[model samples]
Target chain A: MMFFEGSEKKVEAVLKPGQASLRQLGRPFWAKMVAQANAEILSSIHNDDCDAYLLSESSLFVWDDRFLMLTCGTTTLVHAVTEFLQHVSQDALAMLTYQRKNEYQAQLQKSSFADDLASLAPHLSGNAWRLGHLDGHHNYIFHLDRPYCPEPNDATGELLMYHIKGEDADYLRSEGQNIEQIRQMMAWQQLLPQFQFDDFLFQPFGYSMNGICGDRYVTMHITPQEDSSYVSFESNLPSEQLTPVLNHLLKVLQPQSYDLISFNMACALSHATGVQAIDHAEQALPIGYQMAFQHFLLPSSQVRSADPL
Target chain B: MMFFEGSEKKVEAVLKPGQASLRQLGRPFWAKMVAQANAEILSSIHNDDCDAYLLSESSLFVWDDRFLMLTCGTTTLVHAVTEFLQHVSQDALAMLTYQRKNEYQAQLQKSSFADDLASLAPHLSGNAWRLGHLDGHHNYIFHLDRPYCPEPNDATGELLMYHIKGEDADYLRSEGQNIEQIRQMMAWQQLLPQFQFDDFLFQPFGYSMNGICGDRYVTMHITPQEDSSYVSFESNLPSEQLTPVLNHLLKVLQPQSYDLISFNMACALSHATGVQAIDHAEQALPIGYQMAFQHFLLPSSQVRSADPL
Candidate 1:
């Protein structure tokens, strides 16, 4: 089914429900939405009726009346916008953020993130994608409400993606990499000790798991098919928790290459400093593995780095 | 439309028309077939009703009663199998070859290559795909007739694909690569002095050109989008002609990483010898660039290489 054909998208939506939890209402609602969005339903419950949804392309988490859905491939996600409206009252639609990699031209064209934002918040002051290649890396940021508009000197929570290639890709796709075994070991290890999670191993191939830590969530999808094997990790954790969490995931996955998207929310780190921190955190990478690309996206008033953008 | 979204497919069919050319009959027939296949047309004529057919996803060439259609994305190409039957008398069909990379599970599942071949020639004995990752290099070859059964002793044409990443990917996607300009210069430079060709620079991005030298042909497609810039080259030329031809194109394209598919057909080159030839041919690559991978598809009778597969 090409679980990794297109870009994996992550959407975060805040809610205004009077109740503290929407656990009971979230599962069936998402299954219907996935069917409507033309995605295959693999699972909708992780723990005994816990509200976690896993589709072939991506996953979704619902908590504290807030919701987050992440998926990939040529899914008709725009339809989910209207469906989201049906689930939440107008007042409960507090905020929304949609982000995707800048690949897949037709899929991107099919999206209406800007129009959807305008309809949801008519007077919004910030809307637009930060799209372009900076240095040797590509950055794509789509925002609604509080746009990805950190102050020039502010170093916000960073978001990053890494693409594993070469020997790393070989190891992960090989049986010796023992991904299925790793998944079992991880379940016991509980990388995030505080979170309750759900996992699924696709018949004969692929692996995915979703974890919930209070209001925040983290998910991973491993496409272990021969030619296009890939693995992705995403979370909405605080900046302080980024390195340790990333390190733990890296240890398990051992991806050959990874594309890191650091959405620096409101921090004060400089470009060089940020890269150095990432390099140190990922120093577990084996020898001959090179940091072949690096990029930085700064606010308009920030002093630009001398490197080519 | 993401012309490069899925794997690009190439289908070569030979016919036994009485006339030397199919020029008068080819265009309208393909236009009808494309309409039936539900594809949008971009151009079918190169210069004043020329015989080339270019669709949003693929291109077609008709000459000497032979046809080659190359298309990418999700086009229902299997339908063309029946369409070919209608176009020719029972005895007029000569040979057919269909090629696609081992990506796109949905599309690959949709293909009826093996089924069609079985119906066409039930007694055919050879069939198998060259599928595996050897020494960090992935290779996939499925055949209709001879099969990619290169004996360890037989030096069949070798197929190789290299992925350029990081800084190299950055440089190739930039306008500074001057590929379109190189195409113009090459038209006059006559790098392959024996061929005549037509070229098109996609509006604001990408470049594609088709060249014919007798029954042999060469084609190139470069997608320069920032996030997924890629270049592909394919030909039916002999092994003796490959090195010089590849060197010229590499010099002009300067792709950071290239995937070369050398289909070793009925040759006697040993595995190590073939890799040595490729390494020597690519010596023009700048310093610090490395040959990070090597793989081979040896026949069952031949001993496999010591490298991990």
Candidate 2:
């Protein structure tokens, strides 16, 4: 259970460039907090003004005015939550979406704030849903509305999240064995040529890369360990490129089996938009993978309506 | 690509329960056709009113009033297409969904009707979408609306499909080296307690079972080969219990890598309904899978609308 423990904590914070330069303060600031979270620092890549730190178990990205972090394994990400609040105290926290799975075993209990959901519920102002399984791996999600520090009417932007986790920890690492080959393939594909890329290879276990495309960025992380191998791809660009990006990512990682989850801030009434994204990958994926599971996260208070004609 | 040549031809025909019983006209009818398609028949199992057949490449399921057949490999299902039209002429064909993937190779050209799409396109009425990759494996879907022969609207029910192929199929056969053990596990699970189960074991390569659960039926096929090993689980039951059914099926087949496709005639506007079905199996699936891809087929002309809060 200790080895099986993993979490993906993504915090979206608002920062202003003039106050604290991302290039000058971002990398060092996050590196210290990663250590504070009890996560081993493997490598950190800086591009434009954003710093992407690859931890032993997860990843973190710091931009000029925004912060996004995810950590897994026994890393006490909860401990760093207070630190993040302190560091970005001046900058507003726009949104916070924390997700965790594989939370069934006892050893992972303390590391997972999900274990204390009842207590944590009061502080977080957002919607939460559990896949509802006590004996097996389960998915838990918590989302906070825009303007983390509440304001009358602040609609910064809609944050969309898409994730796919390979079914087995060991299988994930094995799929990432050909990281160099994948990079070469991506280069051949000429994905996002406009961006300046900063890439890093972890000494023994993993690799990571972050591309800065103007103000937007796309980052990828792979932690190829036997006990807990994981790879994550994230971007804040328009949805137009989502299909190709995901297709290339799947080709590079090639997980044997995986589960897909999407949190769409924009409207996608009947999985219509999400389904299109998956369809694009189907053409590129090698035969033999089943999209065994998929989910579109929505607020519990929301009601379903018929698709538009 | 040569080894990747695969096709799943699923034909659905309407037969009346009182006439042309599957048990009476099924086995011999399909056995002869399997030979006609240039595929060898491994074995067949009949239970209650449904018949399940295992072939060198894919599978077949026949019910009292419906027939579902899928064939892969160099089976030349296109040749059998004429034969199927002939046999089901009396029963009347309800619907047909023929899907082919990895069909770019020259060797499979003659066996694939896809090669004659120019000529075939005019005959089929449904919309078609080709993943459109000529050099690599791609998904191509062809669907025809019900009443294969003009008849009144007949809503049989929603059909769900889930399948997985072993990564090193040869390895799966080696693991499945224990045939008797699999049978014992099935027995312990009581997968279909009320129905009489007739199981079949192929000479040296595969295994299949069909359970006739009253009016509903479940069938499974496994061809654990190195180059083209595959296992499929399909059922025509209510969605309420679909999750548990799939869990047990996955456990019995224990496929390392799998693909799932669901053709739901019923409503599942939000992936919310679909996610619930998959969440049921999450607790049971072993590690090492990435749910790599998924697509929800929609009415070709339908448009999207925002959700009602």
Candidate 2 lDDT tens digits, A217-295: 6766665553344455666655555455666555454432233433331222223222322211011001111111132
Scored by lDDT, the top model is 1
Return the TM-score for each candidate structure.
Answer: 0.55, 0.39
What lDDT tens digits, residue by residue, belong to model 1 across residues B1-309? Answer: 122433555665555547445466756677776664455456644433235665654667776666677665566554664565576653554445555443322222334334434544533223333222211222222233431222232221223223334444455455545665546533424557776676666655666666666656666665656434555665666656645566655444443333344433322332321122111111111111111112221111221111100
Q: Local distance difference test, per candidate? A: 0.47, 0.46
RMSD value for candidate 1: 13.1
Interface RMSD, per-candidate values to 1 decimal? 24.3, 22.3
C-alpha lDDT of residue A154 in model 1? 22
User: Chain B TM per candidate, please?
Assistant: 0.60, 0.61
